[model samples]
Target: MFSNLAIDVALGLIFIYLLYSLLASIVQELIARLFNARARVLTKGLRRMLEDDDHSGDLGFFGRFTFFNFFYELGWSVVYFFQPFKNSPFLKQFYQSPAIRYLGENSAAARPAYISPAIFSQTMVHLLRGPHKDNQLSDADAIRECLAQNSLQLSADTLAHIRDLFEDARHDITAFRLLLEAWFNETMTRASGWYRKHTQAWLLILGMGIAAAFNVDSIAIARILMKDKSVREQMVQLAMSRQPQYAAITDTLIRKNVLHRDSAFFRTDTTWKVMVRDTSLIGVYGMLRNDLGDAKNVLGISRACVTDTTATGLPVVRCGFTHPYQRNGWLIAAGWAMTALAISLGAPFWFDLLGKVVKFRSAPPPNTTVTGE
Candidate 1:
């Protein structure tokens, strides 16, 4: 019975960590947008590909100019649109093709907009080969002159490669276009890695903040849950009853709310209203509300575990402090650190752990027959 209770306590902690990680992710997304980290990395890559001098630090113009910003937003939009389909093999192959993926057969004339290395290469090639006096220039010369005019810098090796490709495919625009696409794809892949690294870093920072804000002392909570049989039983029962509901809500949240659209960008009133109405954001909101409603009960348990009586016989609260640096100090700090680390592991990790625990609990005990019977 004690062993089963321990498992329940562990599952309850996993559920809390999952909730914390989800909140952290939402906060991290907002922080990413506020910093425009994705856009900055993308624009930096574009500048490197276009420019002549690698020393030039003039990316202010990209932010200032509407033309550059438009392309930046368009590129990110493409990344955002395909995010949900990242796990789908067919969609992944479709994204790499030159042909645009249309919404449906009925919308044949209207193609869903997206950007890729191929698209980038084609656009730049058209820009360089535009109808004007510059059209008379050779492809290599035109590309060089365009880079010079824009004050964009490319590494000597990159420039040499581009020039060689241009010369080799001087008459074959298709072959040159393919080479350019390959180069851009490689560079963009690296940029994507950079974006992901920054995002993880932001999540860690947010996790620590959330741990402190909620006073999520894992060590203290575990001790309390282990000693208090009544509270442990209540928590176990609540977890068992709510696990299915939580799973359903989480599925809806991921499929319909979190991954359906880019959370970083602002939306129109009509779109925002529709999202609010249909998305699982409301489900998350309700979950949080319910958790907050239970906060007092949780606090009561904490107080019962840690409270003391003064000489006057008045009860003094000793456990719940937002900062871990007071009272039991180092021990409390360790608990906070444990919570922050767990949160950094992310929501999916905790959710998977919870699922396994639930599965184990649901499994039947080994069959046994009494010989005396």
Candidate 2:
């Protein structure tokens, strides 16, 4: 009985964490989009790679301050915005070049989230070669001449490095571009790692914030689930309802049926019927309402605060100071830490774990037979 109850409690807790981790990821994606985070990170990586400037890696004395960290990221976006006009540097020229410029929108602030290494190599070769006639210097020789003059503002080490790559390519222009592409690809792999680390850090912070805000105390929720059979069953049912989202070969219509479509099904019993139509103006409001309803149901945190209907047919809701979180500060903190750690494991981890746990919980107990042995 204890073992069975333990499985049920675990199922409930895992379901809640899965929901909030997904929520954290969605918020993180929104923030990334708003800040153009990928482009900013790519730009920083490129600046480091080509310009050979270590100064860009840190924000100086201000960078040492934790409070100013966000301002520094915001500053990167600002720099990305003004990058086109700052053509004094070779990095700026590379960004503004015809081939590179078209990758992003015409707007000054628009930055491409990705640039192929092939394009990078080709653009660098063309920019460095300049407009020398075929009879004059060969493309490779022109590039070598530019490096010797240091006209591209390349650091001495960077210049030396390119010269070595040029020599390694036997002074062949095409071969040199191939070598450059390989170099860029290697550097980009490291850049991708940095971006992933940044994302995980953001996820941790968002997870803790969401856990605290919703009073999603995993310990408290687990205790409730273990003690209350009805609550445990309800949580399991919710988990089952959500499982269809992970279906790999499910048909589009079947997938649609598995998830609620509030706009299409508003006040309708049939899937094909629509009772109320929402316009563009009210769509955002509807989405927010739906999201809030989902949050209340999935997190099981809505029970902390009660809403009672008054005698005059009005609703009264009490929150904040009256909430249980105020009373169990230490427990709430511990729960938040646990929740944040779980959420940091990412939604895919929880989703896969939830599936396995649900299967285990539902599996029939092994039969024990004592025969004449």
Candidate 3:
């Protein structure tokens, strides 16, 4: 089992894995850098607009990005309130309500709602302050009454206070909406200001600059997305005709030819190499075809083939307590270890490691265990 092919495959996979990881990190860094610079440029523009005494209601770049993000997040919080499956239902109204209203429902997490500048709708901001002229009740009371209307009960004091705050709630809603409209006007003016300041930059992008930027960003995103699990699977399936039983041992083949270049689309006959890294503590396994073209599945290896030579050609593989993760890149290391383990210990040792990772992904744990589930 300690064959040259297996060693070469494993070494290739590990190298590819490292390279892919580095590239991914670099892309992420680039995005972060751009985001921060973009945010700063916007912030500076907004500050300039806000400083102009004669400037109309406008927030500029700073208002749109820095301020908008906070406000948008504030609005998004309200979305949670509207979420059908969310814990609190009365608060659904607050997702559109100002931050004060949001907190009345969830005091621990609430913050002020900022106005959005997209369609220019926000006009009422008075409701967001300490006390609007329309105040009729405390924040706590309005939410409690709303909840009670929906059948959720509260303490006697909560009930009494809500009965008093009816007018405040009504006025508060109006004021909140008005704040958004007014803020919208200001932010729009600010955006206009930013444009005036960076007109040259804007023109550059509008001309050939944007076109090049589009190409660069598009290429980076495509590369990042191509590295996904689904893409790798497709590549393997496409290459099945030529590289028979290619599952565990051909990552070098896959990475060098198929993946980054999308050779599957052009090359009719080839093997696909892929690398799998365990990103979560929760054990998981996913199937990937070993070829880059749509040929017959030559790499017969699968989680089920743990006890046999499997279509991929060599030994059976499994995931177990010890071996929690497996990937094309690790195949060389795994194959040799298995070969040695088989020689000195037994097949179960290798099979167990592979078994754990495979079954977990197949019979995945409850939502709690899955990342971003």
Candidate 4:
């Protein structure tokens, strides 16, 4: 029973962390939207490819048009279903024409919001080749002429790499395109790493904020759960009830709105449209409320477990807010820090740990009675 109780406490703590992490993610997304962080990062990356130190002029008309169009179209497609942009009148107006809407729907499968190296290479090649000028020039000359005309700058190393590829491909357009795609893939990989690093930094900052707001002190919660049998039992039951629904809800969210490759968020397909209609935090909370009763009941359990109080009344339990100047201030700070760090581990990590703990709780107890001879 003690072992089972300990597992329950661990699971409860993990569940709280997971919720905090999800809230942090939602907040981070909101911040990104408010600041247009994605567009800014994308523009910075594109500029590196389109501008050179030596050729410090604005891109040619065609170059500007192609790049800006790509940015606008990709931005609309990616963010159209996100909460921050879903109801934009401008996007609605842009897609009002049936023909344009149909084209957008059809092309969505081929164009993810995140610009890949392959996509970049393909777009660049198409722009460089231009309209109705197919067999007019060698691939190498066409690439060089396109860059020169656009006043685009490339680093010395990148220029040398392209020249080497041109020689190796013997100016074969297809071969050159493939080489460029490979090079672009490498570049995008590095860019992705940078993006992820910044995202983690944002998540950590948000996690700390959420921890403070919720007063999620891990040490206090652990002590309360270990000592209070009733609270522990109630929490374990709540977790058990909530665990089965977690995967279904999360999977639906990913399939309908989160995954870039899925592209189901804005599809005209009736089934997909129905599935994505309620892909919001409120929707998920509603589902939980329907299954587990009031969402506040669950939150109350977590709050009661972590909150520090000074009451010395009967049925006493240590939980409630603690001030930094209090006698145990350092301990409270450590607990808050631990909670914040757990949230930074992200929701999936806690979900997995909760699953394992639940399985452990469900296992049959060991037999202690000896068999009669």
Which candidate has the top score in lDDT?
2
Model 1 residue 345 lDDT score? 73
Most accurate candidate by TM-score? 2
Q: Each prediction's Cα lDDT score?
A: 0.57, 0.66, 0.31, 0.55
For candidate 1, write residues 180-260 as lDDT tens digits.
Answer: 877776776666665555566666788778767767778877876777787676766666676777677555544433322
Off by over 4 Å in 2: 1-3, 56-88, 106-109, 247-300, 303-326, 362-373
Per residue, candidate 3 scores C-alpha lDDT tens digits across 199-281 of 32332223233222211122222232244445344432232222222233234323432112122111122111121232310
Residues 58-155, candidate 2: write the lDDT tens digits: 87777777667777766755765566234227677777788777766436435566777778888889888997585898887788889889777776
How high is each candidate's TM-score? Answer: 0.61, 0.72, 0.18, 0.63
Ranking by TM-score: 2, 4, 1, 3
Please write out the lDDT profile of model 4 over residues 306-330, one tens digit for every residue. 4334566445356654333223767
Candidate 1: TM-score? 0.61
Q: Residue 260 in candidate 1 has what lDDT?
A: 21
**Which rank order by lDDT, best down to worst?**
2, 1, 4, 3
TM-score for candidate 4: 0.63
